[model samples]
Target chain A: MRDEAVLRHSNIWRPETIEDIQTKAELGRYRIRGFSALRSRVLPSFDDLTFIPCTLTRVPLEGYREKCSTKTVLGTRFAKKPLELDIPIMVTGMSYGALSYNAKVALARAATQAGTSTTTGDGGMLMAERENSRVLIYEVLPSRYGMNVHHLRMANAIELTVGQGAKPGTGGLLLESKVSDEIAAMRDLPAGVDQRSPCRHPDWLGPDDMILKIEELREATDWQVPIFVKMGASRVYDDVTLAAKAGADVVVVDGMEGGTGASPDLLMDHTGIPTLAAVCEARAALEDMGLYGEVQLIIAGGIRSGPDAAKALALGADAVYVGTAALIALNCNKPIYVEDYHKLGTEPYACHHCHTGRCPVGITTQDPELVKRLDIDEGAERVVNFFHAMTLEIQMLARACGKADVHDLEPEDLRALTLEASMITGLPLVGTNVVFAGGPGWKKSTHR
Target chain B: MVRQVECTGKTTREINQEIRRLIGDGEQEIVVLRPQARHNLGVAVLQPVKLVFEGSVGYYCAGMADGPSVEIRGSAGWGVAEGMMSGTVIIEQNAGNSAAASIRGGTVVVRGSASARAGIAMKGGTLIIQGNCGYMTGFMMQKGTIIVCGDAGEALGDSMYEGRIFVGGSIAEFGNDAVIQELTPEDREFLTSTLTQYGITSARPFQKVVAGRRLWRFDKKEFATWREAL
Candidate 1:
């Protein structure tokens, strides 16, 4: 007979939780990690919603023959030159310090090839990235590392970053292992030091001050490029309104599932709302303020596939920014370097050791030896293929729903597969004509 | 050539545009009148010209300019001459918080007392305060010199990376990772020359504060320092 004590385990004191407690006790500090959160409890996601393709009730376009336009335009409100893209997909800001030189150049090349844009992250713009990119969006993060006015004039667009979704309330963290001499020089910090960026901008404090800040950027750029205000998705409704009111040409909302190079594990899992809910609230806030189409919206965080991008577009995003998914396409966790992954005390496909700065794939490390493993041209080709595939998927879904243009695929074409998703999206449940819960200020329009 | 631009009827954008236009037209010295504490005056003037604000200006006056010498005759608001690449900004009277914040190059001189967070996150350049400054002066300073001719408030040079702060008068408190260092001959010479150039004189010897370098890397043994630094 088996012992009853061995069979009965307390739910609160699971093995993982026990390990975490023991590890913290020994370390005397919170665990720092990389990548997105690893929450066991599932949150409402894009997978919980499915499109209802047109049938006899509605005339469907030929999926194979009909053209579905995916063209997207952003920052048209006050910018003399707005960002126009052939597709709705853009690469999000991943800093040069967080990513290797090869990875940054490859992303830039791929973005240029795909007729979209790539953004510079916390660290200042790399010269090679500028040379490779056709349209580059320079991010002015809180740290202001390597901030130069000459470089600011070279950008096609500017993103004023308040906070990222991974660790909303805190600044960025680069462990000592990643603070190489070159990285240190770029960031103006000492070599081999642990760098923690400040959470607040040095000059501006609140939205009232931000209006002048935006004007300053405009004056610096000669009002040539669009100004985008990016924020972590918490209190999405109020924050979106504030950003729009602050004279932002574009508002980018990064949800809780957003990826990071390094952050405290507790903050990654516990902070910010999910992308599914953030998009809804962001749309409601814009529509409430009567600035829905006038002020372009870009949704980010945990967007992996074409279906996810398509859903974001239908939910009112002018475009979508992909980070971790793009990294995955460049072989972030592929089983090529099993030995290195093992050395980091993890295996491929389950490795979250980016904070250690010994990235097996060379995508997120500063080590010269590891960085040699990634071939820039080859990585760029793979990312371009992935972008093409994702675009095809979005077009296929839009054509199946009788949409000539992908932006025409509205909320009416979607039905929630779960009760929570139904409530979150304000859409009807599958095989039901009634919506159980209308999302915050979500107006229901009659089907045509 | 000297040009006069009035700020009474025009918007901030128009005033800045007029400044740019006059600069482009080879006007070397431009005088701004009405001087009703407007924000963002003479912003991004890349040319090496002179801007004289007849009176007080609001936030971010002469911010992000590459090459320009700006003189404010009256008091100024927050972030005066922030992110300036090259040039000189002289404030005649009491200045608001965060004056000369995150400037990369050039010198910012506040003739009168300044408020909190003066010279915060200074990448390079010199910040001179003729009178007493408020709390957290020279916080997170990376590389530069900050000379305060009078007493400084609490937490001077907090978490500084690689900069030198010289306070002529008493310091309320020192910030984390900040330690008092003996002033070198070079420090004394720089202080004397810079004060004379800015037309300020000091009575007492100055104290130099620098980063302790304890918070540079993480160590399990230095848990006490890490606790506060983190």
Candidate 2:
């Protein structure tokens, strides 16, 4: 009704922290809070969702029902072995403090079943996660919650979490409700109280200190793990470049639509660049520095489907990290638990408290009874199936593009309609010079 | 042969190698004559053999112990027993910050009081202090037990959970979620048994404390704006 509302709606730059976003996402009326609408907005994840048919111009390979190579390598730039993940989909970090132990267990099992890596959240290494996951990446956050020096040594990979898309420069809080004996033990916090993780790491002050922290962990672990640094997608190019300079083996950038277990509503709806903008900036930065192939880019936030994975790969992400998607696989919004949603003070799928742990789906809760409702075996199977389907779909699209590998999916195949997107992503507008590769927007090399 | 291993001049790696050799050779106990400052950066990298050091050691003295009884005759340094896996570490003298912090299992006994921030961010296991402890003892500590024979300096057991803190002396303050509770007979029995397990012969009564049970989950209303690091 007002000019401000029109401008806000028309423009991508809301200047709002994610906290203010109200999805108006009705789970049959009890609107889900704390998340940006994944489906809204005019920007298409991709156009035509089309794949160029294999022809004389582009030769398609029949996906080996038997032998077409599908193995993906992660942390290749830093790790000696570089994980040979069976699929491209990754299970993102969901803390043991925020979600039930069984939920974490299911995620690990599911990822393992799908032959992909599962990341451990701030709650440290889960025994189930460690045993189930073939390749396990450990997350190191500001709070040092549940971070054990020994486990750090044992981690297959280590991710230094700088910020989340939903909540940036803010701490992680596991409310009093989720703290069970196990959760408390994992995070080393008392149950039924807010376990707030500091926003800044105690020992690491800035990017420079973060570099040394990387070396310290590498030395401590005898250089066994590939180190990954993740951040909310605010200053994408600068952050990605700095991360690469800081010796990150992989850079994980989570965009605005990224989901969180628990964050202020103001932060969830606002803050950070969109996923499309972020992936483009990070890719350009890496490619400009000749670190594109050398340093892997993993994108997160609001990735929910195979086509989304394809869009990310086309945008130059080596792999995709799925958070909300995996939760969905774990029956996050399954229609069956409409009743459970009400009991937890929200609607099924809309109840993201993953911070509350009272999830009736048995996904997020510390209550022994609620936790018991989740069967790791069953839940894990669902996750595995979801990954399998997404991979198949991605491969199908890749085959349509006449591409043999995921890396072949290029930005030339993509188109962006919004001026805000062009500015935010730092990407060359398709067939236009408003933006160019190694674009005019490329930040000056301050590090070199 | 006294088999007296003098660590006073040896590096951590060299001293630890000797400790491993003796323990691996079936020596139930071994004596470490002395140690230089900062003696054990990764002293017992993973060996759980019982050990005794005659003199003071420095930072991370007993860090990451898989299973071992590492005892120092003199005071110890910062981050003692950082994330120690199992077994026991004893300090006959005082200790610096973060004593027995983040231990997954086992026990750490300090005959004297611990310095400031003792057991900060501790995970599991038992910490026994024969004397008083410094400020913010057990800060952000979760799932374990801490016993103090003397008064807590300030803000004892800040942000503690699940585990119990039994202090014979007065506590200056308590952290969020941490509250003093009546020591039940079961608690007394457990404390007594736990003390016996560590051979802690103390006469004062122990007070039991615990973290209130609650959890924060992701949902619509609360923490809607609290940003999370992706």
User: Which numbered prediction scores highest in TM-score against the true structure?
Assistant: 1
Say which docking band candidate 2 falls in.
incorrect
Candidate 1's C-alpha runs over 4 A off are: A1-8, A444-448, B220-230
Compared with the true structure, what per-residue lDDT tens digits does model 2 show for residues B1-230?
22457766676556666766676677766777857654344444466555777788776677667777787889887667766778888898898777886677788889888987777656678888889999878766666788898998778766665677888988888766578889998888888897787777778777777765432233444334332221
Q: Compute the DockQ of candidate 1.
A: 0.45
lDDT of each: 0.89, 0.71
| Weakest ten-residue segment in model 1 chain A by summed lDDT | A439-448
- How large is the interface RMSD of each prediction? 5.2, 8.2
lDDT of 2 by residue, A151-258 (tens): 776678889999887677777756656667777656655455556676755433578757755655554565557889999888888899899999999999988888
**Could you give candidate 1's per-residue lDDT for residues A224-299 as a string of tens digits?**
9999999998989889999999999999999999999999899889999999888888888888888999999999
lDDT of 1 at B134: 93
Kept native contacts, as fractions per model, are 0.47, 0.19
Scored by TM against the true chain B, the candidates give: 0.94, 0.85
